[model samples]
Target: MDRSSPAGNPLPAADRADGGREECASEVKAKLVGAKRWRRLRRLLAGVVVLGLTGWFALPWVMPWPAALSRPVPAGMRITDVHGTSLRRLLAGGMRAETPPKLPEIPKALVLATLAAEDHRFYRHGGIDPVAVARAARDGVSAGRRVSGASTITQQLVKLTVPRARTLRTKGLEMLTARRVEMIWSKDQILEQYLQRLDYGNLHLGPAAAAAGYFGKPLADCSLAECAFLAGLPQSPSRLNPWRHADRAVKRQQWVLNRLGVLGWADADSLARARAEPLKLRRHYGFFMAPHFVDLLLSSLPETSRAGGENLTTTLDLDIQRTAERAVASHLARLAGKNVTQAAVVVLENSTGNVLALIGSRDYGAADGGQVNGAVARRSPGSALKP
Candidate 1:
């Protein structure tokens, strides 16, 4: 009863069953292999993700977060007049003050100019701007040089707060710190701090100092053209120094104005007016008026306060000091023919040791030992020490 094929061969049932079993086994093995491969791939992907997360969270530990950001701003020695107005700022170790003068609500023109000059999408971005970075890269490639810096204001703040050498690692840290800063501070706060800490050539730090140094006015009182000029200095303070290079500084100011116009922040008439506005820059002889008093105040401070940024209200009357200086100069001029050149004067309040007027020398401008403070200079006490 066995079935025969058309070729006249009888079929074997056991051989057919064995062939079917072998085929089923091969299919099962293939499936198991595929499953194993998928599981291995998933594990590899998961490990990569875990490592990336670990690195992102742990990288800050390698360099350690800067403690300077958390500590109180080290304001250098600020010598103030009796009226509490700052007379001179003696920088401690050449470091700027951490707490700058209170800046008024930033002018709209200044804000627009800053945004146009620095980062246009400052309000919209988080901490980093990938689009700007990509564009900078492309531009750099095309120009064969770095045409633009793709740093956000937040990034600049981080760099200013925690200075480091320019490197890949440092830039990575800046980005990480910038993100943390954004999370902790508001956009306005960030901008405020940036404006407060920015440099404006000739050792002028912050808008307040820059305003006074450049325009002989307060930050709140600076005009629009002055504001624009101040706003354009943070990029390269030395190169854009208004004192050394007025023409270049004006050009940069014009550029800022142009940017403002392009952004619709300024109208054509206003822009033209600003461009034509003349800058009346005052000469900045920093800390010149009260040099001796400043030195005494600095020496009297504690080691901690000597680190700078302290506002010291001395018992010095500026008017009386000027009078004493004039008197000394007049007397010395009269005695010039007698071969007497140097003189010192000190006036104190009758009730207290408060110094009212101090003339350290006849003339601070005199070429002969003008810097030697005669008030505290070591000399024979004469008959005064006898009693």
Candidate 2:
């Protein structure tokens, strides 16, 4: 239908031009709104598909962990027990190799403490924990780098087996291997391997050496408090060396106790007492484990030992070695200040020429000097032995 303005004549060209421009503007707004709606719908659909694919692809990588793990000791090598006090074989005993120590010598209380204190989700997560990963990611974002670790107990076991961490490449490889281990081995098997491969100086590997070191108790006979103490050591043995820093050792021990508390393994009263208690420093099993031959054999050993298939026989008459140490210590009071106040004794088999008994010193340590091997170390005879 034709419309007319108030003016009697047909509308002027300028009026017509104004009306056309308004119509054009309305059409442009409609097209722009339609385009925006279409774009938003596309974006929403894309997001859903992406999420679905991500979940599908991540299935293998983020699936639940395995149920069990198999033990991996060398095919025929027996897991030996060598705690010498009882009639049972001692961990470092000269006579017997070792069989595995039963799961928990002390209690679940102590073992859980160590696992929690060192790693809270050790058993619950896969080789690595996602919560830890998220935490690490947050730290990285805020600080421009990582502050926490993502490695799980299994990953640590893999790293532990590596024995060296020279590069990122090596670490990545260890994580890969740890994942494989988680797939194949049971949790107990992994735990056993970790215990077995653990570093416990002087060819004495595993918890056995560690138990022998701190408590003078065999791995199997470790008391509740003692196991907590020894298990706490590997986290930082040197820094918390009981002999060097009694305070550090005590703190670590308490930290372990606290770990027990976290796992609800320790009682409230015991936790409080352990935390408040002063360091009850004790001589480590250094002498008790090896007795007479400890210092001598250690001095003779090279910086690093190679544990190939070669069976090396030591030079010690177990009976005689025990006797010599007792004899020398008893005689110390009579011989305290003769410049040669400290004494060492060595016995050798006449036939095999094996240096058997080597009692380095009455005291476990040297004269405040940095680690002097008192046994193999021969102080000049001082003209004592008449020529």
Candidate 3:
């Protein structure tokens, strides 16, 4: 054909037409692929926008931001000796009081130990730690078990203040609330409140009560070792209680010290010294000298006052309370052979009608209804009431 002469080569019209058709087919295929890519990109963008919108609007409803970060501190009757020194706390309905020492008054060692044990990044993170969470998730997946916790100090504090069921929804709420708590409270303030509100075993709530209950020392007076020991209690308070399981408690304390060492808060020498330091704990029943008197005082308080963290000062004398307890025990011991099993004593000031001492039972440690307040028990005074 004339096409061959133009190019100086032999060519057929059918072949030329076939080549054009092939090129057109390729273009059509490319356009189809491009359309598919555009559709996929559009879908991805739409999904992201929808997710963003959902999170932005749904978060508030899920978390429901609080007006204030203030939580109810556990309140109890802080009965003292006649000379005004703290004798024992009478918890309201067995609830420990949240008597946190002032932040300045709390020992620095204790604060550091607590931070090391509970949340190493307490000062750095803003409520939630994505890195920790991711690591925890990875570890859990690798181990084929959920072994670690990713909750920050703020998140733990939120959980404590606002108890909820353990679920994905609750976790989402906790994350949101923790962020809100961070916004409302300073880091130091949040820490102080957390320490004060934390529960220790044996009905000891807060650092101050825990210090006194476990070590028989004031919060500021706790040694580094003791501080570490106390700092570890909040994790599993009942299981690791020093009174019940001293060895386990010591092990947990060592774990805390190791954490501190890793965090550069303590040196090898210091950690060793702390480990060697023996804990001289003054363990006793939850109720100390004036169990009944404390119970009575707690019962007498208004519900609002008890829940609002009010402290009660009573006329009960610690020394007299001890004496009464001893006398009751002695009389009961003597009467044991005569089938007399229980006794109660109530000593009062005649002039002011103030209760000076109250012995609820012969032995509050005894298993036979020891917790029952004999002083308040309903009894018929057969001949004694005749007068």
Candidate 4:
């Protein structure tokens, strides 16, 4: 080979060696950069987790905001008809009570039964119950999912009042609201309002209404078994309904009764007997006392009208209400299962919205209001629920 051909121009050995060293250095630097980036991300995630735990455990204080500035608009319930109603019904001194009021005062027994059943420690605990949450967490882990509810009534109130898109962020907001609601309302106030306004609590509507609608008596009159049935409805309103799923509803009712038994409000034998009995729904689902009128009335109203109001009685006649329900139930014998299984019957006085016979469900014990249409919805399709 020629010792020096210009075309060959062999590079110096030093130059080749320097090029190799530079490539090695670049690779080393790339690895170091990646390690640092990974550490930074881990730190960011850690910070988020720490903040959530702090809020959850510490249950940090929430500053009060004015009701006007608060989230929800006013709660409204509109009454349609008013013929024979004593809008001027007297109070203690033969005076009329407040108009557009809340449900009749909660019964002491219903209150006691709920307390005995739902939260024995409700009186003892502040906003959050570490023990209950821990138990629920254990249950969730055991079930391999979040099936248990660790929320207290206070927590539920927070969710109900604070309207937010459901998300992690919204959940945080709910906790924040719950903490604040705890500060503002007393335990009794919270409990009363919760039951009175509880959505899905019953077919006739709020708890007081539900007690009245179901037992055909006042909240004060709920039997131990009946109250157990009502209390259990909140957990899974649709599934464990005493009216439809007499069995499942009985199961849930038993849970409440069991709790009551544990709390000393009831005896084991009483609870067992109640559990074994079938739900005796006073009226057909959604039938109330007057089936045809209710069907006609609900069909006449618009969607906006379902909005509830206190003292909004209908013009239904109790005697006539029974007749209509019997007619339908008798006519649909094959549907006895489906009728009691799922129904919504609301009977009203034709002239007044004063519900003469409001049977929100067939198996008032099990009906989901929405489920029963025993007489079926029988309303106009595509038309609003109440106009």
Model 1: residues with Cα > 4 Å off, grouped in runs = 1-66, 95-99, 103-108, 376-387
In terms of TM-score, the best-performing candidate is: 1
Per-residue lDDT of model 3, residues 108-191, tens digit only = 988999899888888888788878899999999999999889998898888877788999898988888887678767999889
TM-score of 4: 0.51
Q: Which residue pairs does candidate 1 place in steric collision?
A: 75-308, 75-309, 76-308, 76-309, 77-309
Writing each residue's lDDT as its tens digit, candidate 2 over 70-168 gives 323321122111223221222333212233344554345446656765667877765666788788889989998767767777877776655555688
lDDT of each: 0.77, 0.59, 0.80, 0.58
Instruction: Name the runs in model 4 displaced over 4 angstroms.
Output: 1-104, 163-168, 200-202, 267-278, 284-387
TM-score of 2: 0.53
Q: TM-score for every candidate vs. truth?
A: 0.77, 0.53, 0.69, 0.51
Off by over 4 Å in 2: 1-107, 143-145, 164-166, 200-204, 276-280, 284-387
Worst 10-residue lDDT window for candidate 2 reads: 74-83
Q: Which has the better TM-score: candidate 2, or candidate 3?
A: 3
Q: Could you give candidate 4's per-residue lDDT for residues 7-62 as a string of tens digits?
A: 77765677667766898899999999999999999999999899877675555455
Q: Order of all candidates by lDDT, from best down to worst? A: 3, 1, 2, 4
Q: Write the per-residue lDDT of candidate 1 for residues 119-142, one digit (tens) a residue.
A: 888989877888899999999999
Residue 343 lDDT, candidate 2, scale 0-100: 66
Worst 10 residues of 1 by lDDT: 95-104
lDDT of 3: 0.80
Each model's total of backbone clashes: 5, 17, 0, 47
- TM-score for candidate 1, please give it: 0.77
